[model samples]
Target: MTTTVGRISLAVQLLCRAGVRVLAVAGSANQNWLASLGAEPVVYGDGLEERLRTRAPNGVDASIDAFGDGYVELAIKLGVAPVRINTVVGFLGARRFGTRSDGGMAAATAEVLAELAAMIAAGELIVEISATFPVEQVREAYAKLAERHTRGKIALRMR
Candidate 1:
């Protein structure tokens, strides 16, 4: 399950490309986009676990948490093994549950980056650029990021 503005789109794409059935937990605004990437988009908030259970009755084999509020606990409740769960922004939860906190560092090898680059170059992967601003407008860029509803990355034009 994922949360809004958690870069969930990229995760969904990568997982789907790897043949994993992804059930994206995001807000309603992103449902169509997530579905386009082959993820089963489930609206987040309130009875999230029940929603997830309804979607995947067999149980989730693994989970990735980018939107930290107790997602690790939710994943555990859904029966995902702690070893198979990774949280990018849930260090506290990872510590409490023994789940892995493998974010960019764990998978940021040059080869992996190059592979992703190649995919993007070949049009096999789409990197959504929600907005762009000049470097001088860095504060504005961050302000937009702080809104937590960006559809994709916010790029800063250095040139």
Candidate 2:
């Protein structure tokens, strides 16, 4: 499952565009939102490894490690080929790959955002809201995230 469910929609959209049937690991949001974006949300109980092993027995086509470090290493272990692997922030132990745009990450991020917006406009993606609290409650917000398994985002209001 993704550590940040709020951002996974872009990944799912990209995967769908590439004709891949994606299975997302939604660690903090309703599974339906991901499904609506063309990914099957597989809950990663215990740990990511356990979920990967159970879901992709023959190894995954590719595993992108957005979480970096230990996560990238685990993705490498599960991928069938080197090209089927990469990470947003380069990890120490994994092979580095070029992103879609050579204009650096900012450009790629923009592209992802465009895709997300398009999906939202088309009513193909749904935003999942877990909770919202005043800025003064930031500590409590973090505590709640640490203590429970939420199905969506925990946002702080500034005004």
Candidate 3:
């Protein structure tokens, strides 16, 4: 399951393209958008485990938690192996549960970046740009990012 914002859109796209059935856990506002990208969006909050079970009766193959709040445990509880579970914001959870906390670093190879860039250029991938601010507006850009509801990257344009 994934969060509403962050790199969830790209994750969903990549997973869907790989023939994996993506069950995206997002906020209500992003549910429809996630669905349009071939994911079954489940609203995140209380009883998320039950909701996820209802969607994937057989169980999930793996899980990635971008908004870590006990999600590492939740993924383990959902039957995902520790090695297959990765969290971007759950370093403690990763250490405690032996899960991977390797986020961008693990997947940021030049070849991978080139592939993603090619997909974006070929219209096979979509990178949602939540907002763009001039370099002078760095503070304002961070303020917007701090709100935590941006759909994607809040770019700081170098002007």
Candidate 4:
């Protein structure tokens, strides 16, 4: 499971707390931040296959493709079960590979949303606020967020 320090990380953290062995891969250098949230952080670099081969020798339970760069097939090639794959990004190869996203089949219920909100409110999860900027400082806010080593969310106050 890969997640950013934004809203998604909160959910991933909860899943990890619920006994899921989450392998959280951050796109930026904030990998250690994810580790602090009880996830195995995967830093981006070379030898990815070797790393994955060592870490997930038994095959992954599922792979969530947040970047949507046709990782569903890549995950399958890595021996993850196809049925367990899901993607938030548009499927570019669905027609060619005949694989559909699992997300499309499920909808978030109000109860689920409330429970998640409760978790956040209770501080059972951590939300990273790396930086915040007013509307007038959009460029600065974007720069902070674009930083490779950012550890959390960067909020832009529009109001």
Q: Model 4 lDDT vs. the true structure? A: 0.63
User: In candidate 3, which residue ranges exceed 4 Å CA deviation?
Assistant: 1-7
- For each of the candidates, the C-alpha root-mean-square deviation to the true structure, in angstroms, is 2.5, 5.6, 2.5, 4.0
**Candidate 4, which ten residues in sequence have the lowest lDDT sum?**
1-10
Model 3 agreement with the true structure over 6-70: per-residue lDDT tens digits: 23788888888877788888789988888888888888889888998888888877888788878
| Candidates in descending lDDT order | 1, 3, 4, 2
lDDT of 4 by residue, 61-93 (tens): 766665554566566677765566666553764
Candidate 1: C-alpha RMSD to true structure equals 2.5
User: Per-residue lDDT for 10-78 in model 1, tens only?
Assistant: 778888887788888888998899889888888888998898888888778888888888999888888
**Residue 133 CA displacement from its true place in model 2, Å:** 1.8
Task: Report lDDT (CA) for all predictions.
Answer: 0.83, 0.59, 0.82, 0.63
Clashes of 4: 0
Order by TM-score, highest first = 1, 3, 4, 2
Report the Cα lDDT for candidate 1: 0.83
- Superposed Cα RMSD, model 4: 4.0
